[model samples]
Target: MEKRNQKRLDKKMLSHYQLQLLDDEDKRSVFLIKLTPLNSLLFFTFFMILITTLIFLGLKYSPLKEYFTSPTVENQAAYKNQLLKLNERILELENNLEANELYIKSIQAVVSGNIKAEKVDSLVVNKFHLNPDSELFKPSEEDSLFRIQIEKEEMEAMKASKNTVPDAKYFTPVKGFVTGKFDLTEKHLAVDISAGEGDVIKSIADGDVLFSNWTPDAGYTLIIRHANDIISMYKHCAKVYKKQGDMVKKGEAIAQVGNTGELTTGPHLHFELWVQGKAVDPEEYIDF
Candidate 1:
C-alpha cells in the first residue's frame, strides 16, 4: 500500500501543468500555456547548444584567436636569426670554393707556360709584406757576394739570362712534312705535321706529363712541362700511352699520329712549343 502511494505521487509530479494570466478589472482570462517536463528539458538543451556555438564562433573569427594559436614574437625572431646564420655559412663556403678554383688555375697557368711562376711568387711575397722594394728584401753582404758569383758564372757560359735556350737536346716528335706552320697573326699557334696513320709520336724533351685528356677541338691532347720554363703540346692523336704526372724522357714514345679531333682533316700531329709564356715557331728549335 505504501509503494502504491509513492508511485501515485511521482506520477502527479511528472504530469502536465497549466499557467494562466487574467485581466484584473475585466475579470477575463488573457493567456494560458500548458507545460510538461519533456518540453522544459528540450528548452534547456537548446539554450546550452546555442551558448556553445556562440563561444566557438567568437574563438574562431575574433582577435582572441592569435592569443591561443600563433607563435610568440620572440620565437619568430629566433627562427629568422637561425635562417640568416645558415645563409651566411653557405655564402662563406661558396667563397672558399671560388678561391680554391682560382688557386688551381693559377698553378696550371704556370705549368703550361701561359704565365711565369715568378709572377706568382711575387704576388705571394707582396701579400706578406716582402716585396722587392720593402726593407726586408734588402740583401746582406753574404747574399750580395753569392749573387756576384752566380752572375759571373752565368756570364762566362754566355747564358746570363734565364731565357737563354737550354743546352738540352730536342728529339723530333714525328718524321713528317709540315702541313701548317705556327702563325701568331692567324692565331694558329701550332704546326700541323702530315704523317702516316699510327706513326709513333715521341716526347721532344725530358718532362712530366702535365695533362692528357680529350677535348672537342683537340682530341687526345697531351701537354708536357719541361725544364727551363718550356712546355710542349701534342694534339689530334690516335692514342696516348702516358697520363698526367708521368715522367717521360727525350725521344720516349708517348702517342701515335692520327686525325682524331674535329679540327683535323687527315692523319697528322699538331705540335706546339711555348717558352716563357710565349709561343714560338717549333721549326726554329726542333728539326722535324
Candidate 2:
C-alpha cells in the first residue's frame, strides 16, 4: 500500500482533474459539481414562459385585441346560446306558418266563390283549427262573438246578398237626353233624361226585376239589380213590361216614357244608377 500524503496526480493529463488515493482508500474519490444539462433546460423553459406572459399582457392592452378576441371564445359562447334560442324561435314560427298557410288556402277558396264566406266565419267562431286561449282575441272582444249557427245564418244571408250585385252592362238605365244630374244638395240622387213622349224605354242592362210599383215621388218605378255590383232604376213610366224577378237584358223594352212623379216636369224618363250604396254619373258611359 504505497501512499504519499494520500494519492498522487499525473502531470501528463493536465486537461482533466486527477484523483489520487488518500491513505488506503483510492477507490473512494469525490468531485463537487451540480452542473447537469437538466438545470440548463429548466432555465431556458422558464425564460420562454416569461416572454410568453409579457406578450399576452401586451396584446390584452392593445386596441386590436378587441377585434380579434371579440369573435373568439367568449363571443363564440354567447353566439352559441343565441343560435340555440333562434332555432327554438324558428321551430315555433314554422308551426304557426303551417297553420296560417292552411287558413290562407281556405280564405282563397271562399274568395274564389268555391266555399262560401260564411264557412270561414264559422271556422273562426268555433276555433275549429285555432288555439281558443290564444292572445289573438281578447276576452273584451266577446261582444263581437257570434255562434256558428248565427254565423251560418249571416253567411246564408250574405250568400243571398249575392243577388244584390248588378251586371256591368246594366250601369246605364235610359237612352234619353239628360235634363238633370244627380245633386246631393238638391236632394236629387238621380238624373232626369227627357225622352220623347211615348218613347220606348229600354232596360239599361241585364238584371232581375226587383219591383214594378208606383211611388209617390216616382210614379211608375222599375228597379233592377244585376250582377257585378250594378243596379238601375227607371221612373215616370206609363207602362212596365217585365215584373219582379224577370231577367231583362240591355235594350229590352221595359217601360214607356210618360209624365209621372212629382219631380218630373214632362213625359221624360227618370233614369238612375246605384253602386255599392252610392250613386254616380250615368252619362260617364252611356252615349246619350
Candidate 3:
C-alpha cells in the first residue's frame, strides 16, 4: 500500500507540470506574470512622458532663454546705433564732397577763362574776410553795389593825375588794312591794323620818345611826346629804332611792327593818339 500511494503521487505531479506548460486563453494561472503587447506599449509611453517632462523643465530655467533673446533685445540696440552712426557719417562725407566739387569747378573756370586786365599794380585774387550777416555779400547801396561806386570815385581821382592825350593828330604807325575799328562807347581808344612782321613803323609827326619798353598789355610799346602837349602811343612792335630820349622827325622810321604784347592777337600794330591828355579818334586824322 505504501508503494501504491507513492506511484499515484508521482503521476499527479507530472500532470500538473504539463498543465502549467500549456497556454490557456480562458483560464490563466494566478500568481504568474501575464505580459502582452498592450502592457509593453503602456510602459513605454509612461517612460517617454517622464523623460520629456524632465528635459523641458531643465531647458526652460537654463541659459537657453538668454541665448534666444540675445539677437532680438540686447544686440538690436547695438546694431541700430552702429547703423545710424554710419548713415550720419555718409551724409557728412557727401556734403564735403559737394563743396570740394564746387571749388574745383571755380578753379577750372579761372584757369580757362581769359581777360585782358589793365597793366597796373592792382589787387590780385585773394580771399577777403567778411561777416556772413554783413551786407557786403548782398547787393544794395551799402553793399557790393555801393562799394563799387566808391571804387569808381577812387578811380576817377587817380585817373585825374594820369597822362591821357585827347587832341593829337591821328597817325598810321603801320601801313596795313584796319583789322579792327574803334568803338567809342566801348571805351576802345586804340585802332588795330594788320601789319607785316618787322615792317617799318613810321612816326606821324615830330616828337620825343617818351617810353620804349615791354609792357604786359601794350607789348613792346613806344610813347612819343610832341609840341602842344600832344602824345602818341605805338604798341606791338618787334624793334624800337629810337631811344627814350631821342627826338624823331615826321614820317620817320621809329620802330618795326610785331606782335609782342600780351594783348596782341597776332602780328599787328595798335596805335593811339592823344591831345591835352585825352584820347581822340584815330579816324579823324588818318585815312586808314
TM-score of model 1 (CA atoms) = 0.46
Clashing pairs in 2: 165-226, 166-226, 166-227, 166-230, 167-226, 167-227
Q: Candidate 3 — what's its lDDT?
A: 0.68
Better candidate number, 2 or 3, judged by lDDT: 3
Count the clashes in each prediction.
Answer: 0, 6, 10
Give the Å shift of residue 281 in candidate 2.
1.4
Full candidate order by TM-score, most accurate first: 1, 3, 2
lDDT of each: 0.78, 0.64, 0.68
lDDT of 2 at 53: 96
Which model scores highest in TM-score?
Answer: 1
Better of 1 and 2 by lDDT: 1
Clash count, candidate 2: 6
Better of 1 and 2 by TM-score: 1
Give the number of the best model, judged by lDDT: 1
> Model 1, clash count?
0
lDDT tens per residue, model 3, 11-88: 654442212333467565544444444455687999999999987877678777655544666578988999999999
Quote the lDDT for 79 in model 3: 89
Worst 10 residues of 1 by lDDT: 119-128
TM-score of 3: 0.42
lDDT of 1 by residue, 1-288 (tens): 999999887787578988789999997989998877767778889999999999889878998876777767998999899999999999999978776456445445543446544333211111133458878879999999999999677444422223348565689999999999976546666789999999999999999887787766677888887888788989899999999879999999999998887888999999988775456678778888
State every prediction's TM-score relative to the real structure: 0.46, 0.41, 0.42
